[model samples]
Target: MEPEMLQRKIIHVDMDAFYASVEQMDNPLLKGKPIAVGGSEARGVVSAASYEARKFGVRSAMSGYMARKLCPELIFVRPRFDRYKEISNKIRKIFHEYTDLVEPLSLDEAYLDVTENKKGNPSATLIAQEIRKRIFEEVGLTASAGISVNKFVAKIASDYNKPNGQKTVNPDEVEAFMEGLDVKKFYGVGKVTAERMYQLGIFTGADLKSKSIEYLEQHFGNSGRSFYNLSRGISYSKVKPNRTLKSVGAERTFNVNLSSEIFMEERLENIAKELERRLQKSKIAGKTVTLKIKYSDFTLQTRSKTLPYFIADKSLIFEAAKELLYQEKMKESVRLLGISLHNLNTEMKKSVVVQLKFDF
Candidate 1:
């Protein structure tokens, strides 16, 4: 990570309304209205809601009933993942034209490592604008771009302008941006963390940075390290390409809530080991495993384990997950549990598609 060699140039591109936008682009009648793509029936929640719907407080994963209540004009439509994936592939191709150092965050968003890009662009800011413009012109869809010295800032910058726009945050501007940004606007800091920060008088990055590292660590633990560095506009993570999701999963909610951590741990461990054995049996390895815990109060928290290498061994999986159970504070009782495999691969339990994109 030499400073001169790293001259860090990063861009985070996020498609506007993604699934809903693709729907609008493909269908003429759906434009300029509050639309959502999800289960059309009342039993479902919106998977991707349009900006118009967002104006009314309707959001993704929110119940259809609630969405309808928020926006009386909301129109629910069934999802077409196939179509969305097709569009995603197209956008990915566009990204490759600029640099192979592209990391797709989702079908809708990605991080581009353009420190030494093939496009020969001097500024990552211009590259982002050009990419967003090309997507609009060629794909008939709007995308927003964020430009900064690192992925963290770029990811947030892209969202500042909303749909059909782009923004840049240079190194010198980082201080002003962070100082003005709300604690809630941070990527991983959730509602609970935001409230805690507010109570601690950390309403903005300036407020956040004023707190000493020891104070932050005492209050926020491991996440505080990230907060301190981020408040200084620094990030050390790399942008790996064509990342494969390690473990596939399924989780169901119980009518009853588990009152004890031991019961909850066992329930979660079983699910993890079951999935782990299946993956090992298939000869796949994963580096990161995540635990999704939902409490009786309907509040959710997640913890993750990233090993030195991919491993699908049941014992290893269960042990790491069990350790995570005690690593976090869980005051509320749990109602649901889920496990997912991430940062997976084939070489050493590698990604199923890493080779396909790696050689590109």
Candidate 2:
């Protein structure tokens, strides 16, 4: 039999309705009310919704019309990204106090490895609790956390008791916990993937564990090996303190649909300028240029080209996007246009595996 692997202490911390919560905090008059952070126009999309709004079916990425229809009392507020970033910085400062191994996933969520933290605290559960308490006291924000042996389980457990709560999956409890989990609850398994798994008689982790590796590979391709290991509560992903940028992009949703190629080219020029500004701000360049198109019917399509060398100039980017735009004929009126540069010069390298040893 193979020897057992050492367990590492990992924690996932997630803020509760970060943008909406900040708005409420900044203006107490909006407290305990249904509010969404985004435009309230016909073509607007909700960026975030408060818990009160979520009860009325208001959610992020949902249309403003649908959100207002579901919650007649919904109040739409413009997003304040600068203020949100200021608060996010304060929260990240708190995380650094306990461990320098913090890996931020976004402005509101992060994964932390506390196997050898600064405070010398052995119990990750206590560390998580302390961190959450500090955020509430210091930042005036309620945060939830999950503590477990690995990143995958910790991320899932973080959602169990949300809105200012925490949960811990003990090392011995990982297997049973994963077995009883719904397939959709596994990270990266979307609705379409879950439905496909259900069609294959794989509804839960237990069902997934019953399938052979070959069978899973034949159906899931590269993701098959990932699912096979994750179902058994095994994952090797580590928390990198410095995660590299993968792509730089900018997109605009039009207030009016345009069918003419002239209008699209104009929009692409503006998008390419914005994309170039972002790339320059980060001193980053990429070899791949992609054009994203969303038709009036809500259908989406993307076209990409990889050049021999990286380019970050607006003129070059715009030229590349123009080539992609005329590469195929338009199917319908276009409502959205986007330009993205991928294969960045700062792509993240493969993680170095480190054997973690814990006395307890």
Candidate 3:
């Protein structure tokens, strides 16, 4: 390990139930109530749910019907993304006051490298507390923070105490802390990965560390090295600022499935227009166009085509999407339709060729 790695101080800050909290803050009547911000109860999915709703197994990304079944008294509210983005800007301003090395994960979460901060505070824990305090006082929202020597440990530590709390793990304690942690709690270990780990008798970081790199690679492929490094409390990934945009896409689930070819074409055109608008707003064009379809029975299918030139026009995107749609044979009624553009021209630069002439 590099000596400077031990000296780095990183902090991860995550808002507490961001959208739901914003709703509750805007309307006092929503306080202490089980509420969700999403589509109507008759259709769509939950974007965010208040803490009260979570107690009854209601969670974000869950279908509205299932959430209602879990909590009969759940109140559904439409999302206000513009308002959330406004508040997020205020929080980001607070982060800038302390450190310039801020990497925003989303509107509600970000990572900060305060190893050398503008405040010259010398203590990452104190910096995190001050940031959280300022967010509450200025933005009227609470945030949780985690502090450590690296991004991985810091991100995990931030979630240790959620909902307006902070936790810090010093460099010396990182190894011990990781060894005792549950494998399921690791950042990238999702439900399927956790189940696989359990079957391998790797229930904790200590269990994962016991296996050799080759053994792990044989079982888990490329991610085995990541698991091995994280189990030993070693990470070198830096907090990237101004991360590049990867893809622009839009998707919508219909309240009723569409089986007619003409109706599907209309829906595809709308989806393509939305994607074109987003691509234009981002000032990006892509060579690849992808069409995604979700059947009523929950089956998903995707088709993609790469064009010779980049395109961002609505008509062009719609035409490409229409071609891909007809190429596939429909097996079931589609419940959702989506269009996406990939291989974006966000950072493409013109190449320069130099010629050298030698004189004798």
Candidate 4:
């Protein structure tokens, strides 16, 4: 690893069951109970499940019906995205108080580059504990943190002691910590990839490191290189505070499935209009238009068409979407439809390399 990479101090903070915890916090009656945030109807999908509910197999993206079947006593509440965003902003404000190099991955988590911070604090371990402490005291919520030499290790460590806990992987501990790590526990290696790794006798970081980069690239494409570096705790990806917008999209799930092309087109038109509004609001134009379709059985498919010119107008966007819709025959009744614009004009940005150093 490069000397600068080893010097970088990164911390990943993640809220504990953020949405469900917020619901429990606002209403004390829900505390310590098995609760899920999302609709309870048959077609409803679980957005977030409290730890209590997780014991019964309730999880985000699981169908509400299945969640109930797993835990019959589970309680369901509607999602309040506006309220979630409000709290998220408060948390980000706290992060900014420590460092301007805070990169939010979502409403619940973020990566902070604090090698040089506002607090003049050199110990990343102490910084993580203090940040988690402040989040609980000020926001009436708990957060867990992981401190390490780089973003990848920090993110994986954050999950070590979850539900309001913190872990710090000093520079000296990174190698052993990563080698013993289960392949499944490596960040971004989903079930499918893990299964593939297992098939190849790569059950742990050490197993992954045993393979040649050329061999891995042959099996996993570009991701092979990423796997090779992460296993050795050698990621150079910085904490990017101002992440670029790669795509803008809008999707809708209907209460009823539409099988007819005419009905689907009517819904697509409305979705196209919404997409146009979003693009105009962002003051961006793209040359590629993609249409997403979700079937009643919950399968997803996407179709994309790259035009000769950039477009943000509703008519042009709708026309492109319409052509993609008719370009293929429907296989099943459609439950969801979405439109997105990609390859935006505001797509290029220069990356800066900063000196990174880590210490406990």
**TM-score per candidate, chains pooled:** 0.74, 0.94, 0.94, 0.93
Better structure of 2 and 3 per lDDT: 2
Q: List the candidate 2 regions with Cα displacement exceeding 4 Å.
A: 1-6, 347-354, 357-360
Candidate that scores best on lDDT: 2
**285-324: candidate 4 lDDT, tens digit per residue:** 9999999999988799999999999999989988999999
Q: What is the lDDT of candidate 3?
A: 0.88
lDDT, candidate 4, at 149: 86
After superposing candidate 4, which stretches have Cα over 4 Å from the reference?
Answer: 4-6, 351-353, 356-358
Q: Quick one: RMSD of model 4? A: 2.1
lDDT of 1 by residue, 1-360 (tens): 453343377889999999998888888899999998886535566889999889999899897879999888888888897799899999999999998888898899999887777877777778888898899888889999888777888888998898888888877787789888998988679999999999999999999889888999999999998898778777767677756554565354555687777887778767877787668666677778777888878798889989997767777777777788888678787777787777767542222211111100
Please report, in order, the local distance difference test score of every candidate based on alpha carbons. Answer: 0.80, 0.91, 0.88, 0.90
Q: Model 3 off-target regions past 4 Å? A: 1-7, 348-360
Comparing 1 and 2 on lDDT, the stronger one: 2
Lowest lDDT 10-residue stretch of candidate 3: 351-360
